[model samples]
Target: MSRIVIILACSLLLVACKSPEARRPISSKSGSFIDASVARNIKLNEKEQAYIKKIMSENPEEEYIASENGFYYFYNIKQADSLISPDFGDIVNFNYNIKTLNDDVIYTKEDIKTQNYVMDKQELFSGLREGLKLMKTGETVTFMFPSQKAFGYYGDENRIGLNVPLKCEVSINSIIDN
Candidate 1:
Protein backbone atom coordinates (compact mmCIF):
# COMPACT_ATOMS: atom_id res chain seq x y z
CA MET A 1 0.00 0.00 0.00
CA SER A 2 2.90 2.37 0.86
CA ARG A 3 4.57 1.53 -2.50
CA ILE A 4 1.35 2.39 -4.35
CA VAL A 5 1.14 5.79 -2.58
CA ILE A 6 4.82 6.59 -3.39
CA ILE A 7 4.31 5.68 -7.04
CA LEU A 8 1.28 7.99 -7.30
CA ALA A 9 3.25 10.87 -5.75
CA CYS A 10 6.14 10.36 -8.18
CA SER A 11 3.76 10.34 -11.16
CA LEU A 12 2.20 13.61 -10.00
CA LEU A 13 5.60 15.24 -9.57
CA LEU A 14 6.68 14.18 -13.05
CA VAL A 15 3.48 15.56 -14.60
CA ALA A 16 3.99 18.90 -12.84
CA CYS A 17 7.53 19.31 -14.13
CA LYS A 18 6.72 19.69 -17.83
CA SER A 19 9.14 21.61 -20.06
CA PRO A 20 8.73 25.39 -20.41
CA GLU A 21 7.73 25.03 -24.05
CA ALA A 22 5.02 22.56 -23.08
CA ARG A 23 3.72 24.98 -20.45
CA ARG A 24 3.84 28.11 -22.56
CA PRO A 25 0.63 30.11 -22.93
CA ILE A 26 -0.85 29.76 -26.41
CA SER A 27 -1.63 33.21 -27.68
CA SER A 28 -3.36 34.41 -30.84
CA LYS A 29 -0.39 36.77 -31.47
CA SER A 30 2.29 34.04 -31.50
CA GLY A 31 2.83 34.41 -35.24
CA SER A 32 3.45 38.14 -34.86
CA PHE A 33 6.21 37.48 -32.32
CA ILE A 34 8.02 35.22 -34.76
CA ASP A 35 7.64 37.72 -37.61
CA ALA A 36 9.06 40.54 -35.49
CA SER A 37 12.04 38.38 -34.46
CA VAL A 38 12.84 37.54 -38.10
CA ALA A 39 12.62 41.17 -39.16
CA ARG A 40 14.92 42.29 -36.36
CA ASN A 41 17.49 39.64 -37.28
CA ILE A 42 17.50 40.76 -40.92
CA LYS A 43 18.14 44.37 -39.94
CA LEU A 44 20.96 43.37 -37.61
CA ASN A 45 22.61 41.32 -40.35
CA GLU A 46 22.50 44.31 -42.69
CA LYS A 47 24.12 46.54 -40.08
CA GLU A 48 26.91 44.05 -39.43
CA GLN A 49 27.63 43.74 -43.16
CA ALA A 50 27.85 47.48 -43.64
CA TYR A 51 30.24 47.79 -40.70
CA ILE A 52 32.49 45.02 -42.07
CA LYS A 53 32.56 46.60 -45.52
CA LYS A 54 33.51 49.97 -44.06
CA ILE A 55 36.31 48.43 -42.02
CA MET A 56 37.64 46.55 -45.02
CA SER A 57 37.65 49.73 -47.12
CA GLU A 58 39.46 51.64 -44.39
CA ASN A 59 42.29 49.06 -44.35
CA PRO A 60 43.06 49.01 -48.04
CA GLU A 61 46.57 47.62 -47.62
CA GLU A 62 45.52 44.41 -45.87
CA GLU A 63 44.09 41.61 -47.97
CA TYR A 64 40.99 40.06 -46.47
CA ILE A 65 39.31 36.77 -47.27
CA ALA A 66 35.55 36.57 -46.97
CA SER A 67 34.05 33.31 -45.76
CA GLU A 68 30.73 32.00 -47.02
CA ASN A 69 29.51 32.03 -43.43
CA GLY A 70 29.55 35.87 -43.42
CA PHE A 71 32.88 36.69 -41.76
CA TYR A 72 36.25 37.92 -42.91
CA TYR A 73 39.84 37.10 -41.94
CA PHE A 74 43.43 37.94 -42.85
CA TYR A 75 46.46 36.07 -41.61
CA ASN A 76 49.49 38.00 -40.36
CA ILE A 77 51.54 34.79 -40.28
CA LYS A 78 50.75 31.48 -41.93
CA GLN A 79 52.06 28.09 -40.90
CA ALA A 80 54.28 26.31 -43.43
CA ASP A 81 52.15 23.15 -43.49
CA SER A 82 48.82 24.78 -44.31
CA LEU A 83 47.20 21.41 -44.83
CA ILE A 84 47.31 20.57 -41.11
CA SER A 85 44.55 22.19 -39.03
CA PRO A 86 42.56 21.37 -35.94
CA ASP A 87 39.93 18.71 -36.49
CA PHE A 88 36.73 18.21 -34.53
CA GLY A 89 37.35 16.59 -31.09
CA ASP A 90 40.99 17.79 -31.14
CA ILE A 91 42.12 20.01 -28.25
CA VAL A 92 43.32 23.46 -29.34
CA ASN A 93 45.24 25.89 -27.20
CA PHE A 94 45.43 29.55 -28.14
CA ASN A 95 45.56 33.14 -27.02
CA TYR A 96 43.09 35.74 -28.25
CA ASN A 97 42.10 39.36 -27.97
CA ILE A 98 38.50 40.38 -28.63
CA LYS A 99 37.39 43.84 -29.61
CA THR A 100 34.57 45.77 -31.16
CA LEU A 101 34.94 46.84 -34.78
CA ASN A 102 35.13 50.41 -33.43
CA ASP A 103 38.51 49.39 -31.91
CA ASP A 104 37.40 49.12 -28.32
CA VAL A 105 39.15 46.20 -26.66
CA ILE A 106 36.82 43.95 -24.71
CA TYR A 107 39.22 41.27 -23.53
CA THR A 108 42.73 40.00 -24.21
CA LYS A 109 45.06 37.13 -23.44
CA GLU A 110 46.67 39.22 -20.71
CA ASP A 111 43.35 39.53 -18.93
CA ILE A 112 43.19 35.74 -18.58
CA LYS A 113 45.33 32.67 -18.96
CA THR A 114 45.93 30.71 -22.15
CA GLN A 115 42.63 29.21 -23.27
CA ASN A 116 41.99 25.68 -24.45
CA TYR A 117 38.98 23.94 -25.95
CA VAL A 118 37.92 20.88 -27.87
CA MET A 119 37.57 21.90 -31.51
CA ASP A 120 33.92 22.11 -32.55
CA LYS A 121 32.79 20.68 -29.21
CA GLN A 122 32.96 23.55 -26.75
CA GLU A 123 30.53 26.45 -26.88
CA LEU A 124 33.21 29.02 -27.61
CA PHE A 125 32.02 31.90 -29.79
CA SER A 126 31.02 30.53 -33.18
CA GLY A 127 33.08 33.04 -35.13
CA LEU A 128 36.24 32.33 -33.13
CA ARG A 129 35.76 28.60 -33.55
CA GLU A 130 35.30 28.96 -37.31
CA GLY A 131 38.40 31.14 -37.55
CA LEU A 132 40.47 28.67 -35.54
CA LYS A 133 39.49 25.88 -37.89
CA LEU A 134 41.09 27.86 -40.73
CA MET A 135 44.43 28.09 -38.94
CA LYS A 136 47.25 25.64 -38.28
CA THR A 137 49.43 25.44 -35.19
CA GLY A 138 51.61 28.55 -34.70
CA GLU A 139 49.56 30.67 -37.12
CA THR A 140 48.15 34.02 -36.10
CA VAL A 141 45.26 35.81 -37.76
CA THR A 142 42.60 38.46 -37.29
CA PHE A 143 38.99 37.53 -37.86
CA MET A 144 35.97 39.84 -38.15
CA PHE A 145 32.49 38.53 -37.67
CA PRO A 146 28.95 39.85 -37.71
CA SER A 147 26.98 40.15 -34.51
CA GLN A 148 25.06 37.01 -35.32
CA LYS A 149 28.22 35.01 -35.64
CA ALA A 150 29.85 36.53 -32.57
CA PHE A 151 27.29 37.01 -29.85
CA GLY A 152 23.93 37.42 -31.56
CA TYR A 153 21.38 40.02 -30.32
CA TYR A 154 22.07 39.64 -26.62
CA GLY A 155 25.86 39.92 -26.95
CA ASP A 156 28.14 38.64 -24.19
CA GLU A 157 26.12 40.61 -21.57
CA ASN A 158 29.33 41.84 -19.98
CA ARG A 159 32.19 43.26 -22.01
CA ILE A 160 30.25 43.06 -25.29
CA GLY A 161 26.90 44.72 -25.85
CA LEU A 162 23.80 44.10 -27.88
CA ASN A 163 23.97 43.74 -31.66
CA VAL A 164 27.68 44.54 -31.68
CA PRO A 165 30.00 43.20 -34.38
CA LEU A 166 33.42 42.02 -33.22
CA LYS A 167 37.02 41.42 -34.30
CA CYS A 168 39.37 38.89 -32.76
CA GLU A 169 43.12 38.46 -32.96
CA VAL A 170 43.86 34.78 -32.53
CA SER A 171 47.17 32.92 -32.18
CA ILE A 172 47.01 29.16 -32.45
CA ASN A 173 49.66 27.88 -30.07
CA SER A 174 49.03 24.17 -30.46
CA ILE A 175 46.56 21.49 -31.44
CA ILE A 176 46.51 18.13 -29.68
CA ASP A 177 44.85 15.24 -31.48
CA ASN A 178 42.46 13.20 -29.37
Candidate 2:
Protein backbone atom coordinates (compact mmCIF):
# COMPACT_ATOMS: atom_id res chain seq x y z
CA MET A 1 0.00 0.00 0.00
CA SER A 2 2.89 2.41 0.77
CA ARG A 3 4.53 1.51 -2.57
CA ILE A 4 1.27 2.21 -4.43
CA VAL A 5 0.93 5.68 -2.75
CA ILE A 6 4.53 6.54 -3.61
CA ILE A 7 4.00 5.53 -7.26
CA LEU A 8 0.85 7.74 -7.49
CA ALA A 9 2.77 10.72 -6.04
CA CYS A 10 5.64 10.13 -8.54
CA SER A 11 3.17 10.01 -11.46
CA LEU A 12 1.47 13.28 -10.38
CA LEU A 13 4.88 14.98 -10.03
CA LEU A 14 5.90 13.79 -13.52
CA VAL A 15 2.64 15.05 -15.02
CA ALA A 16 3.10 18.48 -13.36
CA CYS A 17 6.72 18.69 -14.69
CA LYS A 18 5.64 18.21 -18.32
CA SER A 19 6.40 21.33 -20.45
CA PRO A 20 3.72 23.06 -22.48
CA GLU A 21 3.81 22.74 -26.28
CA ALA A 22 2.85 25.50 -28.76
CA ARG A 23 -0.40 24.89 -30.57
CA ARG A 24 -0.29 24.68 -34.34
CA PRO A 25 -3.09 26.37 -36.26
CA ILE A 26 -5.66 24.08 -37.79
CA SER A 27 -5.02 25.72 -41.16
CA SER A 28 -1.93 27.73 -42.08
CA LYS A 29 -2.27 30.81 -44.32
CA SER A 30 0.29 31.53 -47.06
CA GLY A 31 -0.85 35.19 -47.55
CA SER A 32 -1.20 34.45 -51.26
CA PHE A 33 -4.74 35.86 -51.26
CA ILE A 34 -3.59 39.16 -49.73
CA ASP A 35 -0.62 39.32 -52.10
CA ALA A 36 -2.86 38.78 -55.12
CA SER A 37 -5.28 41.45 -53.94
CA VAL A 38 -2.45 43.96 -53.46
CA ALA A 39 -1.13 43.21 -56.97
CA ARG A 40 -4.60 43.70 -58.43
CA ASN A 41 -4.97 47.04 -56.65
CA ILE A 42 -1.64 48.23 -58.00
CA LYS A 43 -2.74 47.36 -61.54
CA LEU A 44 -6.00 49.17 -61.05
CA ASN A 45 -4.22 52.26 -59.75
CA GLU A 46 -1.90 52.33 -62.78
CA LYS A 47 -4.87 52.05 -65.14
CA GLU A 48 -6.71 54.88 -63.41
CA GLN A 49 -3.64 57.12 -63.50
CA ALA A 50 -3.29 56.46 -67.24
CA TYR A 51 -6.94 57.36 -67.74
CA ILE A 52 -6.44 60.65 -65.86
CA LYS A 53 -3.40 61.43 -67.98
CA LYS A 54 -5.45 60.86 -71.11
CA ILE A 55 -8.08 63.30 -69.92
CA MET A 56 -5.43 65.88 -69.06
CA SER A 57 -3.97 65.56 -72.53
CA GLU A 58 -7.37 66.07 -74.12
CA ASN A 59 -7.89 69.24 -72.05
CA PRO A 60 -4.51 70.86 -72.61
CA GLU A 61 -6.34 74.16 -72.98
CA GLU A 62 -6.72 74.24 -69.21
CA GLU A 63 -3.49 74.55 -67.26
CA TYR A 64 -3.88 71.87 -64.66
CA ILE A 65 -1.34 71.71 -61.85
CA ALA A 66 -0.62 68.26 -60.49
CA SER A 67 -0.89 68.25 -56.72
CA GLU A 68 1.69 66.46 -54.57
CA ASN A 69 -1.22 64.78 -52.87
CA GLY A 70 -1.90 62.55 -55.90
CA PHE A 71 -4.51 64.69 -57.62
CA TYR A 72 -4.76 67.44 -60.23
CA TYR A 73 -6.30 70.88 -60.07
CA PHE A 74 -6.77 74.21 -61.87
CA TYR A 75 -7.99 77.39 -60.27
CA ASN A 76 -11.23 78.50 -61.82
CA ILE A 77 -11.08 81.62 -59.68
CA LYS A 78 -7.75 82.32 -58.05
CA GLN A 79 -7.47 84.58 -55.04
CA ALA A 80 -4.63 87.01 -55.59
CA ASP A 81 -4.94 88.59 -52.17
CA SER A 82 -2.76 87.39 -49.32
CA LEU A 83 -5.71 85.88 -47.48
CA ILE A 84 -4.79 82.97 -45.24
CA SER A 85 -5.72 79.40 -46.07
CA PRO A 86 -7.45 77.26 -43.50
CA ASP A 87 -5.29 75.52 -40.91
CA PHE A 88 -6.00 72.41 -38.85
CA GLY A 89 -9.03 73.55 -36.86
CA ASP A 90 -10.36 76.37 -39.00
CA ILE A 91 -13.96 76.36 -40.12
CA VAL A 92 -14.54 76.42 -43.86
CA ASN A 93 -17.80 77.24 -45.59
CA PHE A 94 -17.76 75.81 -49.08
CA ASN A 95 -19.85 74.50 -51.92
CA TYR A 96 -18.85 71.88 -54.45
CA ASN A 97 -20.21 70.01 -57.41
CA ILE A 98 -19.16 66.55 -58.56
CA LYS A 99 -18.87 65.39 -62.12
CA THR A 100 -17.31 62.58 -64.10
CA LEU A 101 -14.19 63.01 -66.22
CA ASN A 102 -16.53 63.21 -69.22
CA ASP A 103 -18.32 66.25 -67.63
CA ASP A 104 -21.33 64.26 -66.55
CA VAL A 105 -22.69 65.83 -63.40
CA ILE A 106 -22.91 63.34 -60.57
CA TYR A 107 -24.03 65.81 -57.91
CA THR A 108 -24.84 69.42 -58.47
CA LYS A 109 -23.80 72.05 -55.93
CA GLU A 110 -27.44 72.26 -54.88
CA ASP A 111 -27.47 68.51 -54.37
CA ILE A 112 -24.47 68.82 -52.07
CA LYS A 113 -25.60 72.19 -50.71
CA THR A 114 -23.29 74.19 -48.49
CA GLN A 115 -20.74 72.41 -46.37
CA ASN A 116 -19.26 73.63 -43.10
CA TYR A 117 -16.20 71.57 -42.50
CA VAL A 118 -13.60 71.83 -39.78
CA MET A 119 -10.32 71.48 -41.57
CA ASP A 120 -8.68 68.12 -40.95
CA LYS A 121 -11.27 67.32 -38.31
CA GLN A 122 -14.25 66.18 -40.37
CA GLU A 123 -14.77 62.91 -42.16
CA LEU A 124 -14.23 64.36 -45.63
CA PHE A 125 -12.88 62.19 -48.43
CA SER A 126 -9.11 62.01 -48.77
CA GLY A 127 -8.84 63.94 -52.07
CA LEU A 128 -11.07 66.90 -51.25
CA ARG A 129 -9.81 67.05 -47.69
CA GLU A 130 -6.30 67.78 -48.93
CA GLY A 131 -7.57 69.88 -51.84
CA LEU A 132 -9.36 72.27 -49.48
CA LYS A 133 -6.14 73.13 -47.73
CA LEU A 134 -4.92 74.93 -50.86
CA MET A 135 -7.87 77.29 -51.05
CA LYS A 136 -8.43 80.74 -49.55
CA THR A 137 -11.69 82.58 -49.18
CA GLY A 138 -13.56 83.23 -52.47
CA GLU A 139 -11.41 80.82 -54.47
CA THR A 140 -12.98 78.34 -56.83
CA VAL A 141 -10.80 75.44 -57.87
CA THR A 142 -11.52 72.47 -60.06
CA PHE A 143 -9.98 69.23 -58.86
CA MET A 144 -9.49 65.97 -60.69
CA PHE A 145 -9.10 62.99 -58.39
CA PRO A 146 -8.00 59.46 -59.13
CA SER A 147 -9.95 56.54 -57.77
CA GLN A 148 -7.51 56.02 -54.96
CA LYS A 149 -7.92 59.63 -53.89
CA ALA A 150 -11.67 59.82 -54.36
CA PHE A 151 -13.16 56.49 -53.38
CA GLY A 152 -10.92 53.43 -53.47
CA TYR A 153 -12.33 49.90 -53.26
CA TYR A 154 -15.48 50.98 -51.47
CA GLY A 155 -17.42 53.78 -53.13
CA ASP A 156 -19.59 56.37 -51.34
CA GLU A 157 -22.31 53.64 -51.23
CA ASN A 158 -24.68 55.84 -53.16
CA ARG A 159 -24.25 57.57 -56.53
CA ILE A 160 -20.49 57.10 -56.61
CA GLY A 161 -19.72 53.60 -57.80
CA LEU A 162 -16.78 51.35 -56.99
CA ASN A 163 -13.34 52.82 -57.70
CA VAL A 164 -14.79 55.85 -59.48
CA PRO A 165 -12.58 58.84 -60.07
CA LEU A 166 -14.13 62.30 -59.80
CA LYS A 167 -13.96 65.87 -61.10
CA CYS A 168 -15.06 68.53 -58.64
CA GLU A 169 -15.42 72.31 -58.61
CA VAL A 170 -15.14 73.67 -55.08
CA SER A 171 -15.69 77.25 -54.04
CA ILE A 172 -14.83 78.47 -50.60
CA ASN A 173 -17.33 81.03 -49.36
CA SER A 174 -15.49 81.81 -46.17
CA ILE A 175 -12.73 80.58 -43.87
CA ILE A 176 -13.13 81.35 -40.19
CA ASP A 177 -10.22 80.74 -37.89
CA ASN A 178 -11.03 78.61 -34.90
Candidate 3:
Protein backbone atom coordinates (compact mmCIF):
# COMPACT_ATOMS: atom_id res chain seq x y z
CA MET A 1 0.00 0.00 0.00
CA SER A 2 2.82 2.40 0.88
CA ARG A 3 4.50 1.54 -2.40
CA ILE A 4 1.32 2.32 -4.28
CA VAL A 5 1.03 5.65 -2.48
CA ILE A 6 4.60 6.50 -3.36
CA ILE A 7 4.08 5.66 -6.99
CA LEU A 8 0.95 7.74 -7.15
CA ALA A 9 2.74 10.65 -5.50
CA CYS A 10 5.64 10.41 -7.93
CA SER A 11 3.26 10.32 -10.87
CA LEU A 12 1.56 13.47 -9.65
CA LEU A 13 4.90 15.27 -9.32
CA LEU A 14 5.88 14.18 -12.81
CA VAL A 15 2.66 15.65 -14.13
CA ALA A 16 3.42 18.92 -12.37
CA CYS A 17 6.85 19.05 -13.94
CA LYS A 18 5.42 18.80 -17.47
CA SER A 19 3.29 21.96 -17.24
CA PRO A 20 4.37 25.17 -19.05
CA GLU A 21 4.20 27.13 -15.81
CA ALA A 22 6.18 24.37 -14.11
CA ARG A 23 9.17 25.09 -16.35
CA ARG A 24 9.19 28.75 -15.35
CA PRO A 25 9.37 28.72 -11.55
CA ILE A 26 9.77 25.68 -9.32
CA SER A 27 8.58 25.92 -5.70
CA SER A 28 11.49 25.34 -3.38
CA LYS A 29 15.23 24.81 -3.27
CA SER A 30 14.58 21.06 -3.08
CA GLY A 31 13.77 21.17 -6.84
CA SER A 32 10.20 19.95 -6.25
CA PHE A 33 7.43 21.77 -8.10
CA ILE A 34 4.77 22.63 -5.53
CA ASP A 35 1.53 22.83 -7.41
CA ALA A 36 -1.95 21.59 -6.48
CA SER A 37 -0.76 18.06 -7.20
CA VAL A 38 2.37 18.58 -5.15
CA ALA A 39 0.60 20.34 -2.27
CA ARG A 40 -1.77 17.37 -1.99
CA ASN A 41 1.27 15.16 -1.44
CA ILE A 42 3.26 17.63 0.68
CA LYS A 43 3.35 16.14 4.14
CA LEU A 44 1.96 18.37 6.87
CA ASN A 45 3.19 17.84 10.40
CA GLU A 46 0.57 17.00 12.98
CA LYS A 47 1.02 20.39 14.60
CA GLU A 48 0.58 22.24 11.32
CA GLN A 49 -2.60 20.38 10.51
CA ALA A 50 -3.94 20.88 14.01
CA TYR A 51 -3.23 24.60 13.98
CA ILE A 52 -4.91 25.12 10.61
CA LYS A 53 -7.93 23.14 11.75
CA LYS A 54 -8.11 25.27 14.87
CA ILE A 55 -8.11 28.51 12.85
CA MET A 56 -10.87 27.10 10.71
CA SER A 57 -13.07 26.73 13.78
CA GLU A 58 -12.61 30.19 15.32
CA ASN A 59 -15.34 32.87 15.39
CA PRO A 60 -15.26 36.65 15.49
CA GLU A 61 -16.09 38.60 18.65
CA GLU A 62 -17.74 41.68 17.15
CA GLU A 63 -20.86 42.57 15.17
CA TYR A 64 -18.75 42.28 12.02
CA ILE A 65 -18.87 38.73 10.84
CA ALA A 66 -16.39 37.04 8.62
CA SER A 67 -17.18 36.21 5.00
CA GLU A 68 -18.43 32.79 6.16
CA ASN A 69 -15.68 31.26 4.09
CA GLY A 70 -14.73 29.05 7.07
CA PHE A 71 -11.64 30.99 8.08
CA TYR A 72 -11.19 33.07 11.23
CA TYR A 73 -10.72 36.77 10.32
CA PHE A 74 -9.94 38.96 13.29
CA TYR A 75 -9.14 42.65 13.72
CA ASN A 76 -7.54 45.09 16.17
CA ILE A 77 -9.47 48.31 16.34
CA LYS A 78 -8.59 51.05 18.77
CA GLN A 79 -11.19 51.62 21.47
CA ALA A 80 -14.06 53.86 20.35
CA ASP A 81 -12.89 53.44 16.78
CA SER A 82 -14.67 51.52 14.07
CA LEU A 83 -13.36 50.20 10.77
CA ILE A 84 -14.86 51.72 7.66
CA SER A 85 -13.70 51.81 4.09
CA PRO A 86 -14.87 52.12 0.48
CA ASP A 87 -18.09 50.34 -0.25
CA PHE A 88 -18.15 47.27 -2.45
CA GLY A 89 -18.57 49.62 -5.38
CA ASP A 90 -15.53 51.75 -4.56
CA ILE A 91 -11.78 51.22 -4.85
CA VAL A 92 -9.27 51.34 -1.98
CA ASN A 93 -5.49 51.42 -1.54
CA PHE A 94 -3.97 48.97 0.92
CA ASN A 95 -0.57 47.74 2.09
CA TYR A 96 -0.09 44.24 3.43
CA ASN A 97 2.21 41.50 4.66
CA ILE A 98 1.62 37.84 3.96
CA LYS A 99 3.09 35.01 5.97
CA THR A 100 2.82 31.28 6.44
CA LEU A 101 0.82 29.96 9.36
CA ASN A 102 4.13 29.22 11.06
CA ASP A 103 4.91 32.99 10.87
CA ASP A 104 7.41 32.74 8.06
CA VAL A 105 7.26 35.84 5.90
CA ILE A 106 6.21 34.74 2.43
CA TYR A 107 5.37 38.15 0.90
CA THR A 108 5.14 41.72 2.11
CA LYS A 109 5.02 45.20 0.71
CA GLU A 110 7.51 46.38 3.28
CA ASP A 111 9.90 43.56 2.54
CA ILE A 112 9.34 43.72 -1.17
CA LYS A 113 9.36 47.50 -0.65
CA THR A 114 6.15 47.94 -2.60
CA GLN A 115 2.40 48.29 -2.24
CA ASN A 116 -0.37 45.81 -3.12
CA TYR A 117 -3.45 46.45 -5.23
CA VAL A 118 -7.12 45.44 -5.29
CA MET A 119 -8.61 46.74 -8.49
CA ASP A 120 -12.20 47.81 -7.79
CA LYS A 121 -12.77 44.46 -6.08
CA GLN A 122 -12.38 42.77 -9.44
CA GLU A 123 -9.41 40.53 -8.64
CA LEU A 124 -9.39 39.34 -5.04
CA PHE A 125 -10.56 36.42 -2.97
CA SER A 126 -13.60 36.55 -0.70
CA GLY A 127 -11.64 37.11 2.50
CA LEU A 128 -9.67 40.03 1.01
CA ARG A 129 -12.81 41.76 -0.20
CA GLU A 130 -14.61 41.24 3.08
CA GLY A 131 -11.63 42.36 5.13
CA LEU A 132 -11.32 45.62 3.21
CA LYS A 133 -15.01 46.37 3.65
CA LEU A 134 -14.37 46.22 7.40
CA MET A 135 -11.50 48.67 7.37
CA LYS A 136 -11.21 52.45 7.11
CA THR A 137 -8.55 54.76 5.77
CA GLY A 138 -5.49 54.80 8.08
CA GLU A 139 -6.66 51.66 9.80
CA THR A 140 -4.61 48.48 10.00
CA VAL A 141 -6.11 45.03 10.26
CA THR A 142 -4.82 41.51 10.43
CA PHE A 143 -6.69 38.71 8.71
CA MET A 144 -6.36 34.99 9.12
CA PHE A 145 -7.47 33.31 5.90
CA PRO A 146 -7.89 29.58 5.57
CA SER A 147 -7.04 27.74 2.40
CA GLN A 148 -10.65 27.38 1.31
CA LYS A 149 -11.37 31.14 1.16
CA ALA A 150 -7.87 31.81 0.02
CA PHE A 151 -6.17 29.93 -2.75
CA GLY A 152 -8.36 26.93 -1.95
CA TYR A 153 -7.08 23.39 -2.34
CA TYR A 154 -5.50 24.37 -5.65
CA GLY A 155 -3.07 27.29 -5.38
CA ASP A 156 -0.47 28.94 -7.59
CA GLU A 157 2.48 26.72 -6.78
CA ASN A 158 4.87 29.27 -8.26
CA ARG A 159 3.57 31.78 -5.73
CA ILE A 160 1.92 29.82 -2.94
CA GLY A 161 1.43 26.09 -2.99
CA LEU A 162 -1.87 24.34 -2.22
CA ASN A 163 -3.05 23.23 1.21
CA VAL A 164 -0.71 25.74 2.79
CA PRO A 165 -2.39 27.93 5.39
CA LEU A 166 -1.71 31.70 5.23
CA LYS A 167 -1.94 34.75 7.52
CA CYS A 168 -1.88 38.38 6.38
CA GLU A 169 -1.83 41.87 7.90
CA VAL A 170 -3.42 44.64 5.87
CA SER A 171 -3.04 48.36 6.44
CA ILE A 172 -5.46 50.61 4.70
CA ASN A 173 -3.53 53.76 4.14
CA SER A 174 -6.07 55.67 2.08
CA ILE A 175 -9.15 55.43 -0.01
CA ILE A 176 -8.24 57.14 -3.25
CA ASP A 177 -11.83 57.05 -4.44
CA ASN A 178 -15.20 56.10 -3.06
Flag the better candidate by TM-score, 1 or 3: 1
**True-vs-predicted CA distance for residue 109, candidate 3, Å:** 1.9
lDDT of 1 by residue, 22-106 (tens): 5666655558888998998998798879889999999998899998778999988888875679999999999998888887989
Q: Candidate 1 overall Cα lDDT vs. reference? A: 0.88
Q: What order do you get sorting by lDDT, best first?
A: 2, 1, 3
C-alpha lDDT of all candidate models, in order: 0.88, 0.93, 0.64
> Which pairs of residues clash in candidate 1, taking residues 3 or more apart in a chain or in different chains?
none
Model 3 residue 104 CA deviation in Å? 0.9
Tens digit per residue, CA lDDT, model 3, 1-178: 9999999999999998984753555554653554654565444433444676565455334333345554555455432354455765565767787788767888876764534455454877666676777678777666767665566567756677875667877877666554
Q: Lowest-lDDT window of 10 residues in candidate 2?
A: 146-155
In model 1, which range of ten residues has the least summed lDDT? 21-30
Q: Candidate 2 vs candidate 3: which has greater TM-score?
A: 2
lDDT of 2 by residue, 1-178 (tens): 9999999999999999999999999999899999999999899888878888899899898888989998999999998984789999999999999998889999999999999999998899999999999999999999999888997778888999988989999999999999
Off by over 4 Å in 2: none
